[model samples]
Target: MPILPRVALLLAACLAPATLAAAPDRAPQDVSGRVLRATGTTTSGEGIPGIAVSNGIDIVRTDAQGRYRLAAGAGQTVFVVKPPGYRFAEAADGLPAFWRTVPADRTAGAMAIDFTLVAEDRPAVSAPEVLLFTDSQVKSARDIDYYRRDIVEPIIGRHPAALGVTLGDLVDDQVQLYAALNAVTVRLGVPWFHVPGNHDVDPGSTGDAASLATWGATYGPDTYAVEEGDAAFVFLDDVVVRPGGTGYVGGLREDQFRFLGNYLAQLPRERLLVLGMHIPVFDTGGRETFRGADRARLFALLKDRPKVLLLSGHSHVQQHYWHAAKDGWQGAAPLHEYNVGAACGAFWSGAPDAQGIPDATMADGTPNGYAVLSLRSGGGYALAYHPARLAAGTQAFTPAMALHAPRVLRRGAYPAWGVFANVFMGDAGTRVEYRVDGGDWLPMRRVERADPRLLVENVADDVATALRGFDRSPEAVPPTHLWRGALPTDLAVGEHRVEVRAFDRWQGEAVAATTYSLQEAGP
Candidate 1:
């Protein structure tokens, strides 16, 4: 028995070390992966060490090898917060692009989830619905308020998944207002993007790249691209301002051109191409100029593509232009260009509404409004124009007549009276003329009256006397004519045609000619 106890003690001593050693080797239920950025072409190259990673609860940074391992519960989601100067693709609903969770069963053993960080190139996808907004141009706090109340609020209410991109003129030369503008739009509850406009550029700024840097700091990248759905969206920095200048002229830098070429080379022609920017490649207004040689080069690169949609917004008007292959453009398919209007109608000018918003009209005469492009599920898309005012009804007009005659009229005499006609837009601005049976075409005076209901009223008593053929006697001949005008005394008793031609603004002219017989009475 004593020998057995000694053997048991020896066995326990042997097993104690093994049990302790096994405990440390046992892996925890939770494990983490590292998202390391590699330089050059080699995977074994230096790892850019400190990157942030989190499994919702535990936040950790990668080690020197760009490797990070964390103790996480099974089936937990792991996401990397994109560091500054880096951006992530946004989902259709504006959610941050993220990697989904791994199933609990898949993560049972020593699991590994790793991401390769690379320099971001323009996004290339299959088909994408691009959001375009032009000329927010919020001038003041009041204007910003109006924008929030009128524009931003309504758009956010829609909850669009497509990314929102503005075409510059974001603030009206008020760089200070950018923060407020951003703050208000951020309320959109989605990732919104912006492009630099002429107003956004500081003409006196030191370097050509300075403005772009400022813009990128506020909004990511002066020009960049991302893929959504099946399309690649290419945003260009087209707002080329002269040094010490504010107005927009067209031109692109050599580097941007090269970047575009490289981006296009990586994208397949079969995929949809969408170009969004502040300035247009082709000057539709005839006042602005094309974006110089670089633009032409970019155009040449895209000319042969099957499908390309170019969106611009500097003109502050709504215009749709399609160039066909027969038009001698380079592309195999025609180019569809849409110029979105300014959010501030006419720069927020004109009369003020009850809300103190102006009835602004853009320089191109288009009212303030926004455009919505929806990608259909079955490989197509639809476009809609949403105007600010909500009007739904039909308008019509009522008609009346007026006549005049002179007091001094004789029996068997016809009177000549000045006649006037009036019409409204609803009245159709009808063409109205009158003529005596044997008289020449007498043009009637057309006047604009303020009140539609009381359009025709008597002008003169002389017109009434002339039509009645009555003598101008105070007691013998009371004025029977509706208008005051003198009658012609040379007409013999006979039937005459009183022709009245009325033409509606929309439906041309019509004639209402009738013959009336007159009988002479002894005076």
Candidate 2:
């Protein structure tokens, strides 16, 4: 198949899915045009010494004069490693002013890039809350308008935390919409960071080298790191375009690994490490979409860190996976990877509601929304899901979920109707219980399967006389947080209420209810 057709099929099928060794002692490589001179300065124009800067493969620090040189390749990005007690200069839209991209054409010339750092007011900060948005795949003017009115407005419902991140796919293929998306993000009133998704790549490019040129121009470095408080956050570009733009693979380049290794070594052993990327590091349902070697290398690097959280966004569905000895993680406890849900749920499909926002519920029945991650000042962290529509103003206390069950069943029928609930933020340890007609609380089985609610929606759209929505939502994918239980059919005839309550591992709870009727068969 042609590249475009293949891309479309991939989208229809699955929506789909560094470096740096030896910063301290090894001497910087001397290449004629490969070197870049980077200076760290404060807003007052004073030289800020001791700031670490990287070229995605090597790590170096500014000297007493606040100047350092990095050996960089063409199309590489050199970003400042944000130090504690200071922040980076931010644009009006709150994107950190921290990186500069080396031109792709100049494979061997030296360039100068300067970074300005602003001192933090609090001197010390241990706990910080970050807003995480993934796969905002907004396409066309209408999508942009919908995003602003729906996703953006609810996210900044109140003054959010000081920092935020968009894991990728800020705009659907049109890179031109980046500015418009940025305009909405600025409303959140915090510095936001980004990663590159497969959609963000420049398909015109021949290979991975130049595929991110446009993205680099719009979002600074495709790979870089920054510090907020006790946490060190690394944003990486893991979408590698194929040789002829056929498709992209999910893995890290040698340069990114080198950079990551070098950068992590400089941070305190106890500091929290948060790695945000577009594609997850693990294989999903035997898809083998992600590179195992890259994941293994990453595990080796973070094996010593007691606290680590990996955040990925390419998968439209929300899931929580803990990597243990069986999954290549060598840590004492399981490594937590939160496959955050998408902002453009089901690619903005399904029927629109009274608010004119598409019911973009994800294929797994997860409502389209963003996430809030709270990092404790000490070390631990907790994450919660915020639905864009339902919990718009009240998510802090309300847990939201999609409950799927038959509305009516014959009293003599076997208990074959399964009640499926997709708790947007539930994990393996989340306690989910369902009761029929205020009966005893019965535990629901945690099942990894397609959400029945979405399956019905897919069937509805597939056979509809006239299309009733923006687009038909895609086929259901296996959900990570779905719970199921067969409803009791041996009941007296009449209407009965079914209620489900899910308590997340963090003690956050949400309740949902529906009514089912039991009827006696007529002779």
The most accurate candidate by lDDT is: 2
List model 1 lDDT by residue over 209-317, tens digit each.
5665455435544565654444556667786665654445766776567656755654556656778888766665445476546555766888977767788877665
Candidate 1, after superposition: displacement of residue 375 in Å? 2.4
Give the true-structure RMSD of model 2.
9.8
The deviation in Å at residue 447 for candidate 2 is: 2.9
- Tens digit per residue, CA lDDT, model 2, 5-118: 122222222211111233233233322111122233434555554566677776666543455666666666777777655666776546777777666676434466677776
Q: Local distance difference test, per candidate?
A: 0.53, 0.76
Model 2 worst lDDT run, 10 consecutive residues: 1-10
Q: Rate residue 70 of model 2 by lDDT.
A: 65
The parts of candidate 1 lying over 4 Å away from their true place are 1-130, 244-247, 284-288, 324-328, 363-365, 377-379, 391-523
**How high a TM-score does candidate 1 get?**
0.53
Winning candidate number (TM-score):
2
